[model samples]
Target: MRFATYEHRDQHHVAVVDEDGTLRPLSGVHSLTGLLTEAGSVPELLDAATRMLDAQPGPHVSEVRLLPPLQPPTVRDFVTFEEHVEGVRRSVDGAAGVPERWYAAPTFYFTNPYAMHGPHDDIPMPPGSSVLDFELEVAAVVGRAGRDLTPRQARDHIVGYTVFNDWTARDLQSAEMRVGLGPCKGKDTATTLGPYLVTADELEKYRDKDGFLRLGLTASVNGEVVGEDLLSNMSWTFEEMVAYASRGTVVRPGDVLGSGTCGNGGCLAELWGVRGRQDPAPLKPGDTVTLSVEGIGSVSNTVVPGADPVPVPIARRRTRERP
Candidate 1:
């Protein structure tokens, strides 16, 4: 079953998305995270959502404001695509190939969960940034808590999938990473999730023999297709990424695991790597970016001008005496 969180008549609701794209509100449920935690399991949640759908559909998808499916407790983005790594290395790192350590295991980085945006929300240009960009990927929402889980065990913990756009500030990211500390301010601006959350069972038909989901992923900027790739191209599957994430830590319900950027042209930074810096220009105010995942859904966000940067003092070095 598909589920959505939307706003109508100034009220927020958690609803079951019907086959025709109409919404059927889950009685008394206003938060997707609350519902997920309350149900404790996907089967139970599905049962409850189904029971609530017996009522008349409330509104058509076009009539309401779509929201980020859930407010995740934590967000971990994994770089699972070898091609994306290869391209970025050549472009940003000025290297020819991927590092061997990348093949050792799935790797990820945490981003600001508080900065999430909904499917159709307006994303402002982050302060002091001129190179605004978008990343096309999918994300898995944890339904049950688990720790030290293996790949197989992790599979059952994921309840649903949603389209994720990991917005970036290219110049800021490049500068900060040179100091070996960040992608911090660069990525803290916005992370888009939604349109709708498709249940794991709903995507079963797309699974390949190797257990990878062979779903087509695409990204467009102002209606022009900028990047396209198959989700199956990732070197490591979501299960592996999730398993690696839980190695020594707990992954709780409502936590989100992003599939990072896809290959080919999953993000503008990757495009800059393949083409030149100015080929496909960085996003500016009034640009609309739409990212779509085959089985899940599409999230389209409009870029808007942000407030002027508030200046801060530059770091000053201090002299130290030998102890």
Candidate 2:
């Protein structure tokens, strides 16, 4: 079943997309806040929520604002795509030596929840970011909380999946990460999520016989395809990521774990290499980027140039000491 949060007639409400493409509101079915109140215990809330949709049905597909499916207690994103890593490595000078361990273990970062935006939302370009880019990823929503869970156990903790666009400012990232501050200013700008949340059951069929998710992912700018790939290309699995994240820490339900950019699947650097050094195409103002993951949904966002002034380096005057 497809679930979404939208605003109709001045009030924001949760609704289920019906078979006929209409938005059927789920009244008294609990707001996003109330739904998240019971995260992590593997509560019957999602089942109950799905039943509510069955009760009041609407169209199959209609125009509506798709908000982030859940209010995550925490949001963490992982870098599990070797192609993206290699592409980034090739971009930077003397960074070609990627540790072999990076290919084995799932690495992740906690992102700011405040930066999340809904589908069809406008992503404001950061100031001085002439090189804005988009990343296509599949984010898993945690359904149960536990510590030190094994990889097998981690699979049971997932409730659903959604398409995620990790918007980026390449120039800012390059400068900030040099200080080893963990992608502060470069990554804190905005992240696009949703269109709809597809339950784990719905996605089960998409999993291949090899036990890997086989969702097709694609990203386009202004209707022109920029990046395309499959979820199966990921070097690390979501279960591994969850198990790693849950190590010695409680991973509550609704917590979002992003599967970083797909292999050659998103971003110009991965698709066409980096600027100047490689003649890659970077995003500019007035470009619309859309990230679509099959079986989940698609999120479309427009990018505009930052209107703020660029920071200027201060010139220091040397004072002569009296002899």
Candidate 3:
């Protein structure tokens, strides 16, 4: 079943989407957090939602304002696609390949949980950097809490999926990562999520014979197609990333984990690997970026001018070698 948080009667409400595209709102639940906090299975949540539905008249999705499904309790974005990692290393430092340790385990970094936007919001082009880009990816929302989970055990913890746009400031990222840290100021700007949240069972048909979700991932800018890839190409599945994230630490119901960027499916990789490192012309004011994943719906955002410019602090290279 699909779910959304929409505005109605001057208040936000959590609702389930009907087959014909109307909403069946839960009477008392006001946010996605309230719904996920219960840790109930999909069917149980649906049953309860159905009861609430009968108490209120439904509204069409077009009549309401949708918000990010949930303000993530925490967010961990994983760099799991080998080709994406290799391409980035090549672009940023002219490295030919991924590190050996990268293959040893699924690795991830924590990003701003509060830097979120809805499907159709217009985000200000992050200040400071002129080089801006988009990363098309899938985000899995954790439903059940666990610690030290294995891939086998983590599978059931994922409750739903959504389209994720890891909007980036490429110039800042390139400089920061060289100091052995960051994607921070580069990525801290904005991350767009949602058109709607699709529960795991809703995507069962997209599952391959091997039980992997083989959704097609694509992104376009200003109605022009830029990158296209498949979720099937990810080397580290979302489950592996989820489990790895739980290594000795607890993962709660509202946490979010991203599948990183797809192969040649981000502007950085596309510019370097496919476009010969030429300027593909990063996103600018008035440009629209739309991202779609097969099972989950699509999310689109527009870039506009920022009020202030953010300065990039590029660290100077040390001459020869300094201790």
Inter-residue clash pairs, candidate 1: none
- Which model is ahead, 1 or 3, in terms of lDDT? 1
The TM-score values for the models, in the order shown, are 0.97, 0.88, 0.91
> What overall lDDT goes with each candidate model?
0.89, 0.76, 0.81
Give each model's clash number. Answer: 0, 7, 2
Give the candidate order by descending TM-score: 1, 3, 2
In the range 71-131, model 1's lDDT, one tens digit per residue, is 9989999999998888776767677788999999888899999998999999999999998
Indicate the TM-score of model 3: 0.91
lDDT per residue (tens digit) for residues 1-323 in model 2: 66677765566777766555577767675465356445432336556665565455543345555667656678899988888887776664336646697976798888878888888888888876777778889998887677899989998887778888888878888887787757776677788879876778888888876667999998888898867899998877788889999998888767899999987647776654433253446777778898889988789899865568567787778797788
- Per-residue lDDT tens digits for candidate 3, residues 86-161, read 8767776677778999989878899998899988889887778787888898899988888999998888888888
For candidate 2, list the clashing residue pairs, or say none. 20-59, 20-60, 21-59, 21-60, 21-61, 22-59, 22-60
Model 2 TM-score relative to the real fold:
0.88
Model 3 ranges off by over 4 Å? 309-323
